[model samples]
Target: MKKILLFALILNSTFFYAQELRLLRGAITENLIVNDTVNETYSLYLPTSFSVDRAWPLAFVMDLEGKGKAAVAMLMNAAEQEGYVLASSNNISDSLSISQNVLIANRMFNSVFNTVPTAKNRTYTIGFGGGAMFASILPTFINEIKGVISIGASIGNLEILNAKQPFQFVGIVNRSDFNFRSMYDTKQVLNKLKFPNQLLVFDADRNLPEIETVSKAFRMLTLTSMAKGYLVQNDSLIRSSYNDFFVDANANVTNQKPLLATYQMSDMEKIFYPLMKLDSLKESQKTLKRSTSFRQANRSQNSYFLKESFTKEDYSYYLEEDIISYNYANLGWWNYQMQELNKLDRSAILFEKQMSSRLRGYINALISDNIDYLAADREPDLEALNLLYMIKTITDPNEYTSYLKVISTSSKMEDYGTALFYLEELLKNGYTDTQTLYSIEHTALFRIMPEFNEVVEKYLKGARYDVIEQ
Candidate 1:
C-alpha cells in the first residue's frame, strides 16, 4: 500500500509540475486537460499577485455546454480584482446525468485542491442558466463548497437545503430573466432557513451580469464569512462595505426606484446585522416601504405576480401533458397564446406589459425544462426535443439556439423542406453565425443543395457555393 501510495503521489506531482509550467498568472489558460480518459479539461485564471505561500480563494464555474474559457472570461476580471482563483471544467455538461456531472466536478475540485493552496472557507461555485442550477446543488452534497453565485437560474432541489450546512448564495439575474421568479422565491426560502443569501436584480436579458456586480457578490461572500466568525473581521472593511450598500439604496430612493431601494435596505439589514448595528439601514427600509410610490408599486407588482403565477401554472401543466403525449394539434393554440402575449407586450398599461413579459419568460423556461428532461433520457425522445425547440422559437423568437436545433434535426431526418424554411427563418431572426450553420449535424447534404446556395447568396453578399447534383 505504501508503494502504491508513493507512486500515486509521484504521478500527482508530475502532473502538477507540467500544469505549473503552463499556468500563467493574470490571464485565462484555456482547455487545461485534467483526465485524459474522458478528455476531461478545464480553464483556469489566477491573479497576478498569486503566491504559493498563502491560501487563495477559489471559484469553480460551470458553463452547461462546457465552454470553460468563455465562462472563465466572464468572471476573470472580477476574480482578478478580488484576488480569487477561477476555474471552469470543459467536460461538465447539462446533457449528462446530474450524478455523472457531479462526479466530474468532484474530480476537478480534488485536482484543484491538490494543485493549489485553496482557502477552504472561501471556496465557491458559480454558473449561468442551467449551469447555475447545477452550482446551487453543489453545496448540498459537496460540503467543501461554502457559497454559490448563481446567474440567471435558481436552486433545483429545495428539499435538500439543510440548516446544518447553510451556504451563502448570491443570485444575479435580470428583471426579465426567465428564472427571476424562481430566484426570488429561493431567496425567500433561504431567508426562512436563516441562510446567508442575496439576490441581485438587474434589467436585461439572460446574460452575464456586469463585472462590478460580480465583484460585489465576491465581496458579499467574504463579508458573510467574516460575520460568521470564520474569518477575522476588519472593522474598517465592514464599515466601508456597509456604507457602500447604504448609499446605493439611498441613491435608488432618490432615483425614483423606491421598491428597489426598499429591497436593497432589507437585504443589507439581514446580511449585516450579525456584523454591526445598522440604525440607518433599518430606517431606510421603513421609509421606502411607507412611501406612497413604493406602496403603489408593490400593489401593482403583487397583481402582476398573481396573474403571472396563474398563467405559468396553467401553461406548465398543459405543456408537460402535451410534451408527454406528442400532441401536435395543440400547436395552433400555443401559437395563438404567443400572439396574445405579443399584444400584451405592446399594451399601454405598465402592469400588463410586466405580466406579459413574465408569462413569456415562464413559458420559455417550461419548454427549456421539458427539452432538458427529454434530452437527459438514456434513449432521448428526439421528436419531443424537436417539438420543444419549435415551441421555443414561437415563444422566444430572438433566441437563435432553437432555430439552429430545428434546422439541424429536420435536416438529419431528410426533411429538406422543413430545414429550408427554418434556415430562412433563422436568417430572418438575424442569426449571422454562418460557420455554425454549415457545421451542424447532417447539414452537409442540405447545405450543398441548390436551394440553400441560393438563399445563402441572397442573404450573404459575395457568398457562393457549388451545388452538387446527385
Candidate 2:
C-alpha cells in the first residue's frame, strides 16, 4: 500500500537528526522559536516510551490559529498511550490559502523532522474543525504526510487530492456534529477511491471528543503500521483495544444509546479488518442490529439525520439570503428558529434532542464561517459581520464574545442606539465581564454614555463610568 510504504520509509531516516534534539520527555513543551524569521513555533510531546535509538511516528497537529499548545494538549494523552511523537504548529491561519497554510505547516514539519527523529513514512496530520479540514488536505501537497486524523471535519481540498498520494484517513466525529452526514458521505468516496480509512462516530460535540475516542484513532494508525510491517504486530494490544471498544459499544446498547453502538460497530469492523478476519465481529454486529431496541434506535436516528440535513440546508439558504440583503427585519425570524431549536432540545424523544443540538451547532458554524470570511477582506462589510454576530448571539446565547463584537461593530459605526441595545441584551442574557465591556474597541465614548452606564449599573450593580443624568 502506498500509505503503508510511505510510513515505512520514516523508520529508516538517520540518527543525524536525533542526538542534536533536546526534549523534555513525558510532557509537552512549547518549542517557542523553531523558525525565528517567520516566528513559527510548535508544541511537542514525547511519550515516556520514546527512545533515541529508534525513529518514532509523528502526529503533526494542525490548529487553525496559533493554538499549538492547546491542540497538543488535546491529544497528548493519546500520544502518550500510543507512543507517537506529537507536534502542533502555532502558525496556521484562516486568512492563508490552503496552499499557503500547507507551506506554513511544512515549515513546522521541517523544524520538527530535523530537530526530532521522526519516522518520515509514519508522519500524520491531525486537526479539529477547520484544523481538521486543513489536515485532511496536507497529504496532497506533501508526500510524507502519510495519514490524516481529522476530528470534527471530513476530507477537504478535494480539487487537489491526488490519487497517487493516497494516505490512511481516520475521521472522528460526534453524531450531533453538523459534519456527521458529510463524514459518512466521505466514507463512501474513500471506499470508491480505495483509500484506507475509518470513521469513528462517538457521542460528544465536535470539539469535545473523549480521550478514549482519540486514542482509538491513534491505535488505528499504529495497527496500520503493524499491517505495513513498520512495527511488529502486537496481538495483545490488538485484543485489548478491540475488547475495550466492544465493551464500550455493548455498554452503549445497554444504556439505550443504539446510534452510538451501531456507529461503534462500523468503526470496529473497519479498524480490525486489515489485521484479522472479522467473522466474529460481523456476527456481533448482526446480533446487535437484530435487537428491537437497535432497530428502533437506528430508524429514529436516521430519520433525525435526514431532518437535520434539511434544516441545515434551510439555515444556510436563509443565512446567505439574509446576509446578502442586510435583512435586520429577519432577526426576529432567526430568534424564532432558535426558540424552535430550544423546543426540540427539550423534546422527550432522543432523536429530536440530537437533531436540535446538531441544527443549533450547524447554524452557529454557518454564521461564524461567514463572519470569518467577511472579516478577512480588506474592505470587510462591517454591517454583515454585525448582522452575523447578532444572529450568533441568538444561536449561541452564552458566547459573550459575539455580543461584544456586535457592540464594538455597531459603536464603530456610531449606531449608539444599536450598541446600547446589545449592551443591555448582553447583560440581560447574563454577561457580567464588566472589565471586558469597558475595554471593547470603538466603545470608549459609547461605554461612557449615560445609557450604557445605566444598563451596566442595572445588570451588574456597578457602572465604571459616572452616568450623569441628562
Candidate 3:
C-alpha cells in the first residue's frame, strides 16, 4: 500500500512539472489546459519579472463574453507593468447560467492556484461588462479574493456582502454608462459598511477602459495592499500617487466639474486614509465644498437625478408592458422615444445629454437581456424573440442583424405582413448585403413571394429571384 501511494504521488508531481515547463513568462499563453479529467482551459500571462522563487499577486479575470484570450490581452499590459499574474477562464460565458459559469471559474481558479505560487491575501478578480458584475460578487464567495476591479458594471448584489469578510472594490466606469449612478450609490453603501472602495470615471464612448486607466487600477490594488500591510510599502509610489490624485482634483475644479472633483477628493480620502494623515486633504475638501461652484453643481445634479429616475421607471414599465403584450402597434412609440433621445443629444445641457445617452444604452441592454432570458430556456420562445428583434431593429436601426432575425422568425410564424414590412424597412435602412438577405432561415417560400424580391430589387440593382415583372 505504501509503495502504491508513493507511485501515485510521483506520477502527479511529474504531470505538474510537465505542465509548468510549458507555461511562458513575459507573454500570453493562450491554451493552458487545467487538467486532463476536466479539460478546463484558460489564458495566462506572467510579467517578465516573474520568478518561481517568490509568490506573486494573481488576478483571475472573468470574460463574460467567454473570449478568455481577449480579456487577458486587455489587461496584459497592466499586469506586466504591475508585476501581477493573470488567468482568465475561456469557459466563462454570457449564455451560461450564473452558477454554471461560477463553477467553471472555480475550476480554473483551483488549477491556477495549484500551478502558480500566489501571494497570500493579495488575490483579485477583474473584468468588464457582464464579467465586471461577476467579479464584484466573487470575493464574497472566494474569501481569498482581496479585491475586485470592475469596469462598466455596478456591483451585482449588495445583499450578499458580509462586512466581516470585507474586500476592496475598485470600479472604473464611463461617465455616460447607465450604471454610473448605481455605482455612485454603491460607494456610499460601501462607506457605511466600512468597505474600502474607489470609483474612477472617464468621459468617452469606448466600452473598454484605456490602458492607462487599467494600469492605474493595478496601481491602486498594489497601493491598497501596502496600506493594509499585506505587502511592503514603497514610499515613492505612495507620494507619486497622492500627487496625481491632487492634480486630478484640481483639474476637475478648474474645468468647472465640481461633482467629478468631489468624487475624486472622496476617493483620495478613502484610499489614503490608512496610509497617512489626511488633515490637509480634508481641509481642501471642505474649502472645495464651500465654493459656489460646488453648491450649484450639486443642485443641478440633484435635479437631473429626478429626471433620470423618472425616465428610467418609464422605460422599465413601458418595456415590460410591450414585451408582455407583444404590443406590435406600440412599435411607433418606441421609435418616437428613440427620436426624443436623439433630441437630447442636441440639447445644450451637458447633464441632459448624458442622461439621454444613458437611457438609450439602458434600454438596449434591457431588451438584449430579456432576449437572452427567453433564449436560455430549453426551447426558446419564438414569439418573445420575434418581439425583441422587432424592437431592436427600431432601437438600433443600423445593427442590421436583428432585421434578419425578425424576418426569419416572422416568416416561420407565417406572419407575412410583419415580415414584408421589416424587409422593406431593412432596405430603407440601406442594408445592402444581398447575400445574407438571400439565405435567411425559414424564408424559402417567404423569399420567393413577389413582395420580398420587389423590396430587394428596389434597394439593390438586382435580386436573386428577379421575379418582379419589368
Best TM-score among the predictions, by candidate number: 3
The residue-level lDDT of candidate 3 at 55 comes to 84
Per-model TM against the reference: 0.81, 0.89, 0.91
Off by over 4 Å in 1: 1-22, 31-39, 205-207, 317-332, 346-354, 372-389, 399-470
Give the 10-residue window scoring lowest on summed lDDT in candidate 2. 1-10
lDDT of each: 0.81, 0.83, 0.85
Question: What value does the lDDT take at residue 145 in candidate 1?
Answer: 97
lDDT of 2 by residue, 237-266 (tens): 888888888898889888988767877888
- From the highest lDDT down, the ranking of the candidates is 3, 2, 1
Error of 2 at 83 (Å): 0.9
**Candidate 1 local lDDT, 1-470, one digit each (tens):** 11111111222222135334356678787777675566688888888777667788899998789899999998899998878999999988877899998998998887677666788688999988888889999999899999999988988688988999988889988766657778888889888889888887765433568887888788888888888777789899889888888887787778776776776777787678999988867776777788898999889878888878888888988888778887868878788999999899788766677567778878887788788778879988877888889888888899999988988888988989988988888888777777787788889889888998777766764334765557
Evaluated with lDDT, which candidate comes out highest? 3
Model 2 bad stretches (over 4 Å) = 1-21, 32-39, 468-470
Candidate 2's TM-score: 0.89
Model 3 bad stretches (over 4 Å): 1-20, 376-381, 468-470
Residue 242: error of model 2 in Å?
2.6
